[model samples]
Target: MPYYCDLGPGQKVYLDNPGPTTLITLASGSAGQQQQSSTQIHTGPWTEVPQIARVGSGALLRCVTAQGTYTWQIQGMQIGAAPTNAWVADQATPMQATEVGLSSMASMQPMAPMEPMAPMRMGDMQMSMNPMTMRMGNMTLGLDAPAASTQQFCTQCGAAIAWGDRFCGSCGHQLHQP
Candidate 1:
């Protein structure tokens, strides 16, 4: 399905697709200068803009499936504004049908503007104890939790150390437990 999110001033859209491939496009301004990226959806989340990128008002995120049928979800967060709007679009017809020039393919039709639903506060979202499950609108994304840290940095010489080390490997400084 194709999805759209209005990222108001200082706002950004976050997408997490734990499986399948997706194409993300960003359009801004009246001229519709666009930037696009194709990403393989692994177990980690990805964003349309860099975490540090400055997002202005009216930024739009357009996402479409690259292949296969898959469940997808996305959420928007404003830098200093609260989360309020959630939009969901109907499932997009598979690329195969559209590419073949099937006369019956609905994907060729222009998408209607999505009506804004009731606002969802950030606090109203549910988070499970297991990090994998995330709910965005009506879709649930299962993501692999990032691995826990098993390494530490040595204070004396700034060398890398395994979690249980008792001495600094580079400078021989005694390691103290905090």
Candidate 2:
């Protein structure tokens, strides 16, 4: 997908699964607060303008970026680490039926759009021990992070596995699979 921007206030951007899920709005703030900034989501070649409003870092915002990646920018996080840009360089590599859990024979279709105005909950503040501050566009709902286990690829058999597996079913390699 080509790059684009989210130019509207309150507008949301959704990304394909396996990519970032949200983008929050941000604007000028007092001391220690960030300066007024615009949030944009670029998808393929279209740049969307968002509705206008003052928003903070911690608020959950959602939008897909110009790189064909989805992102979730929480109000409190830095723009560089915005989930959308996290793997911006990591474009979708077609995975084998076994690699992506998708069969080659199956028809590939985009998923249905999620319900608009869906209620979203961030991480558990108590367990995460994070702060509880809200900002405009405070909630971004469509982002999905891959499980930790999905990040690993078996060195011996070239298969992906949970962090530690004792054995590789594909190549019969030994692993401590987490």
Candidate 3:
């Protein structure tokens, strides 16, 4: 059996599959615009469908089962204001630190001033500084300059391709100028 329901914008539907294996498919959008379809297999008792958002009023949900009839339920309903408990709010209020019988002796005492240390000589410490330099023929080996490149990513699969590569290595899609 198959079931259909119209869902509003920013609304989500939940299906309760207490029976055997069930296949669920969702379709949404208008005729001119591209319609999206998502299919999933549910073996658990409860499964939530993907959130659907339509511009005007064109959101539909379809659920079908092969073994037996399935049940469907809708979630994310706009209900009224939630009920409040006065006793819970009063108990949730935090008590003061003094009222809780917690006292910090360090906070009550004045902090001592820190003294400056004397500068030690290089000989006093067992460390030494050395300047290093490397020259590859006439050019100096340094990371000051950036490397030149014309690398680009493929539009189809987003794989890293060289500046003038013809095809993508990962997805094997052709790259051409139109």
Best-matching candidate per lDDT? 1
- Candidate 3 lDDT, 1-178, residue by residue in tens: 2332345442322222335443332333454542333233554432333222222233222232343222322223321112222122222212111221111111234444655434323432322122222344454434443334445789999888766678888798998733
List where candidate 2 sits over 4 angstroms from the true fold. 1-25, 30-34, 38-43, 46-57, 65-67, 82-178
Better of 1 and 3 by lDDT: 1
The digit string of per-residue lDDT tens for model 2 on 19-87 reads: 332222233344454344333333443233321212432322333346553434434323433453343
lDDT of 1 at 43: 25
Q: Roughly what TM-score does model 3 have, to 2 decimal places?
A: 0.20
Q: What is the lDDT of candidate 2?
A: 0.36
Model 1: lDDT equals 0.39
Q: After aligning candidate 2 to the native by TM-score, how far in Å is the CA of 161 from where it should be? A: 94
Give all candidate RMSDs, comma-separated. 22.8, 23.2, 29.2
- lDDT per model vs. reference: 0.39, 0.36, 0.36
Model 3 gets an lDDT of 0.36
Indicate the residue-level lDDT of 60 in model 2: 27
State residue 98's C-alpha deviation in candidate 2, in Å: 44
